[model samples]
Target: MSEAFVKGCEGLPWWRGAVIYQVYPRSFRDSNGDGIGDLAGITEKMEHIASLGCDGLWVSPFFTSPMADFGYDVADYRGVDPIFGDLGDFDAMVARAHDLGLKVIIDQVYSHTSIEHAWFEESRQSRDNAKADWYVWADPKPDGSPPNNWQSVFGGPSWTWDARRGQYYLHNFLKEQPDLNVHHPEVQEALLQVARFWLDRGVDGFRLDALNFAMHDRALTDNPPVAEPKQRTRSFDFQHHYHNQSQPELIGFIERIAEVMNGYGARFTLAEVGGEQAAREMKEFTHGQDRLNSAYGFDYLYADKLTPQLVREAIASWPGEEGEGWPSWAFSNHDAPRFASRWWGEEERPRAVKTALALLMCLKGNAILYQGEELGLPQAEVAYEDLQDPEAIANWPLTLGRDGARTPMTWTDSACAGFGSTDSWLPIAGPHRAMHVAAQEADAESILHWTRKVIALRNAHEALRCGEVEVIDEGGDLLAFERRHAGHRIACYFNLTAAPLALPEVSGSVLLATGDVAPDQRELAAFSALIVETQ
Candidate 1:
């Protein structure tokens, strides 16, 4: 790698209190009039991303794949898919992003690869092959059934039969995304090679997908059933997922990845972890300086209501101190429904959106802003026939498909909403066109302006960036907390309910507010939020 590729930040930590704008490349922009987003398309929009006042951009997976799980199931790690452009386009995109002062972080799916991956194909060929131990393969039971009772996240047995090997291999998600055997030394080396390849290409960091699932029980034990019934449809929910994921050895592997990143200076790494024991495991994975820089769980992503109590509990769990891992919070993402539609109905959508944005920006840890969230876009209602996510389709009626959150970006009111010349890969209709980027840019009070202003405020305030949070009070629907650093303190308050709220007993000046605030008294309207700096 060139010196520039391994360049370290001068006296700065790449991740501390960073605002990362997440780009779902497929829905971000389109070039060549292909309707689907490509690397070149991202390069064209680098300026808009930089204008958002974020320190970096985290682009989701866009590697060569069969689109089985969109871009999560990688067939080629080093090369970009033809649909998303090739390696050259990715390099150009990286250069352009850097020129705009935006650090580029790409997704890395090391836990599994598409069955079409050459390693998986060769491993399944024969037991004596050079890559036979590349994937997590095992023999079946005497009854010709799966080795254990583990279940796939897509609603079936976790083990799938292979006609050639006459055995079953474990898969935590879809059958096509077979789990890799990270336990093997050779497998670890191969995965590291994939990371090094990207590092050589000048990518700043990686968002490791399913980091907990990278290791599993070597014995292939059956996971015990859950005591309570699950309300969701994923087959994996029936059990506690003991043998399938969150193995202790996963930390050692993360340490190895961290060592590689350390060699490259200021490169950052974050894990996407979620499960029954996710919070505990997340802390463990990032407890030390040698592990991942940060980890994010589903606490905020799956939350139905953003209450004061919920916010307090989530923040309090991770106290800012030495030896404690940092957190990356996200209210909405590509995998789940948008927070605007999920948290508030159409009546309170605009206020709730602004409040949510302010809360996320003021939080002490790193923040991830999902695509289209700045415009207060609601989840699109997709018909059954148009559904694409396998997890959603399998659990239809019970859980909405992720396609609703993966709709194309509404850039203009023109046909296709200025996303492309042709129809979008996913439908874009209803209130989406009216909430287009052009329309929002014309409206001064739009959510986009509120988001930019809050982000700027957070960036400008040192206390809001890396301060320690202390819950001041959680009375009624009012949430109040203090962010303090180097004797500087700022109080953040939120009226989560649909009613006016009086400020807590704190002598401070209102620094920022999502809505109008009375000057004489610290009063805010319903669903409002404010940040006040101490005198």
Candidate 2:
């Protein structure tokens, strides 16, 4: 649990104050030239992840599925999808990651399953089957409409009629993905067993996906309309999601999951929480010792801009007080637009990207780095004809498709960006092809190398890793904060605007700085960041 670094320190949990790399399986790398990344591909790139100084890697789902929602809809919890390779492949990948001293965390979607899952199949067969109550099945209203006013996240009604059962089944996502009856004791036990299965298979942890949707109000009450209806293209955004999700009962199920994970020893569990009540729900989900270790919200992932106020508010939400859960920060991920694309202009991207990465490492929580973020890869321009996200396809020009952010990783300057011999499933951006790993590896001043340096600096300093944070300034265009642990103190300052800002008078030794920012400088240049160790 501990690694020797600075003097006077204790061993910390592997996940505490660690940086985790996120890999979207279908886009990270392709093995066998299948145009889709697989387990073997990720295994081959394990060295690259380890080289980044991240403590671990979180791999998105690769379970048995028909790809209805691209692997988020699981068909079998125990089986591996043929396209991504088999159990043997997964085991080999885990072994390789362990050999590199990296933890492996896999996504677990407990809230729902594919319609093709055995349990869902049996549940839909008849009302008297062994697994009849395995899924959420409700009868229609008087006029044969859906039982309630709940809406699916992918758009339209949350219910789909099954002719054989003569009832409507709840699906928070696509109709092909049916919500599970997690409130049932048997269902809870079944999910716990699934957790144990993976733990036994040597997975270091699990990232619970859409955990707030795990349970619904048993009464099936209609969700009331929002107080002020904002312009929204999707029906799901019109109502307050009171009855459909975020039930208090979800804590009970989370405890059950905790019990299973605790038995395995030192296993990490994090939840992917979203929606309006995300802050409260995230705290609740990881509130106590018998709950999840950490949970991340969409604070930065979906933000329109990265400002000092946003960072301050987000960090304040989880203040590391008594009983408060640890927070994990992610600037970019599979579901959100790349941070570089979301927050900066094309001309200022280089400095802005480096500043953001340094700030993320300096924050007082675990940091999550998306697959291509170290290379400063922007959102790919996926044409409407090539779009593959169901939500983006359904919503069209209204919503920027996630396909733009999930493009295949750029491995080389070759055609197809060396992702595979064949064309990638998602087109590699023309600009991204030029920012390939091979080119960056050859350039000493590339963002990839800067990323490694910042991560290493964080690892070397206890004050930055697991310290108490004190916000000094969070005013417009400038953010200043201090990280304190033991007798070591470090200060971080960021210039979040395009104009120069005079540095506050301070005395310290320069530790790390981005964009020509130095301790001797009196003012920070546009989009610059400075980190220093105060004596």
Compute the lDDT for candidate 2: 0.91
Which ranges of candidate 2 are over 4 A from the true structure? Answer: 5-9, 517-520
Off by over 4 Å in 1: 1-12, 518-522
Per-residue lDDT tens digits for candidate 2, residues 463-527, read 99888898888466688999999889998998888898888886788899875555767898878
lDDT of each residue in 193-215, candidate 1, tens digit only: 99999998998999999988999
Q: Please give the lDDT score at residue 7 for candidate 1.
A: 32
* Candidate 1 residue 448 C-alpha distance from true site, Å: 0.7
Error of 1 at 349 (Å): 0.5
How do all models score by TM-score? Answer: 0.96, 0.98
